[model samples]
Target: MKAKPSLRPEDAGDRPPFGRSWGVLYVGVLLNLALLVVLFSLFSKAFR
Candidate 1:
């Protein structure tokens, strides 16, 4: 039998942001988008 090659190297830090996990970062971004939508809607209604 022959030895198989490795996929990932030994040194690798898979951090998303703020030292948090990927899922946490994703949720934060979604929440930020939702808040922006709400704010824009309010601003448009107030001006129009």
Candidate 2:
């Protein structure tokens, strides 16, 4: 029978060189804001 290989933490890629969570959050916020603006504009134009 063949044996399964064991996994180790060291085998994983190293952590990102710099923190990345904040960048993702910032991008999400910007996208949300943009979507809100577009929605509002469309609604306003429709009402007009």
Candidate 3:
């Protein structure tokens, strides 16, 4: 009989797919959101 595979705490699935770390990804997302908000506010003010 074959033995079952085991799981480890050091698995790669726990890490970010591209960035250096999860914090970097979070920061990037937050920055992007802030930039979008600023641009939208500026557009609203200019159009009015």
Candidate 4:
């Protein structure tokens, strides 16, 4: 089978702000967003 070209390999020249790889950075961002959503939900419930 022939290997396909992927964007990941091309991303070698771009460095993430705070991690070794782009995937780690993405996961961190997603986790942070989830935490914020949870906090906001709690805050809304507390006021209601």
TM-score for each of the candidates: 0.62, 0.56, 0.69, 0.62
lDDT of 2: 0.76
Estimate, for each residue in 1-48, the C-alpha lDDT of model 1 and write its tens digit. 899775454224566437368788889889999999999999999999
- What's model 2's lDDT at 43? 100
State each model's C-alpha RMSD to the native.
3.5, 6.8, 5.0, 4.2
Single out the weakest 10-residue window by summed lDDT for candidate 4: 9-18
Ranking by TM-score: 3, 1, 4, 2
lDDT of 4 by residue, 1-48 (tens): 998776675465787656888888899899999999999999999999
By lDDT: ranked, best first: 3, 4, 1, 2
List pairs with backbone clashes in candidate 1: none
Give the per-residue Cα lDDT of candidate 2 at 35: 100
Error of 2 at 30 (Å): 0.6
Model 4 has an lDDT value of 0.86
**Model 1 per-residue lDDT at 19:** 38
Residues forming the 10-long window of minimal summed lDDT in candidate 3: 6-15
Q: How many backbone clashes does candidate 2 have?
A: 0
lDDT of each structure? 0.79, 0.76, 0.88, 0.86
The per-residue C-alpha lDDT of model 4 at residue 28 equals 89
